[model samples]
Target: MAAFFKAVNAKIRSNPALSYLCSTHFWGPASNFGIPIAAVMDAQKSPELISGQMTFALTIYSATFMRYALAVTPKNYLLFLCHFINEGSQLTQGYRYLQWHHWGGREKAGVHGAVEEAKEKAAAVGDKIKEVASK
Candidate 1:
């Protein structure tokens, strides 16, 4: 596995995008385990083709998002969908939010739509929580 990683790293260093990927992987443990953990939990929608259930993915997303929320705030649209979904809401009410939701699917069509739906949902939830958090 180490050798494989080295080979991949070497290949990536030779390329542009791949090199960036390797660098991030090598020095981006925070995002590696954090964003996915944060985003997944904070995620309102789930991708149909992913390996795990919607709930599982949400959990992963939450942690990852929380880990890098501050650094990625400017790019929140991509990382968390919105500022409303900052660490406070996602970490505090994550379980409550995830309790009843059960997204089920496994199709290629509407993949982008599904992700967008989930992001919208997450943003809405974040907004609601943000309102409460401010109060």
Candidate 2:
């Protein structure tokens, strides 16, 4: 069993790509990408669901790690990319939260406003039909 494992390791080491694939440098950032992916997906959800504290925390976290990714020995670009995406997503989420909570976006999108808007559109359409019939 040890011999088989050793042979596989030797094969992996023989290829530059395969060796990099087996390294933590590749897998660490690859797995960390899920956070950014999830953050991007969350952007589609209602801003009311966003937590201000958590969004702020993640923003700071991503920014810090982005700097670390650049400072590291190998300069992990994959990690930097992951954190860059996460930072953008978190900033977007934070903006949405502020807009919904403090900037009147929620009021404009509320159920009452939607119903009033629909009624106005229906009335306008009815008036247009009446005008066409009268002509």
Candidate 3:
């Protein structure tokens, strides 16, 4: 399926006519995949989206595509979160916390004020995001 999407995206990118079509309001192929991805992980079944393997699969796939990240990777954080109330996951808190490693982005460090700091022995960069977010 990823291969198919990649092919479709590539094809659209290659053709000027298709590019125009993709740029339209709601006729693009992205919506085509969005609806199904949502359905595969039916929201009504589990608050944590545990039944839908597609979300998990996409999380793992997206995370694996990124560089070394913390346990609470952006992919997992967004995907694992519940649409309504809080959700659940097979992933442990520790594992989820570790995905915050974040080796890629422009940031100098990962999670701040979290227990992962003690695990990594990082004391100085603890509040890296605080100043920025507070502003």
- Over 54-114, each residue of candidate 3 has an lDDT whose tens digit, in order, gives 4456455444422222343233222322211112232322133333333322133332434
Cα deviation at 89, candidate 3, in Å, is 12
Best by TM-score, which number? Answer: 2
Per-residue accuracy of model 2 over 1-135 as CA lDDT, tens digit each: 999999999999999999989998899999999999999999999888999999999999999999999999989899999999999999999999999988998888885588789999999999999999999
lDDT of 1 by residue, 10-85 (tens): 8878997676545543344435445445554545554322333443555556556545655653433334433234
- Model 1 clash number: 27
Clashes of 2: 0
What are the runs in model 1 whose C-alpha is more than 4 Å off?
Answer: 1-11, 25-135
Model 1 local distance difference test score: 0.52
Tell me the lDDT of candidate 3: 0.41
Q: Which candidate do you rate higher for TM-score, 1 or 2?
A: 2
TM-score of each: 0.23, 0.76, 0.21
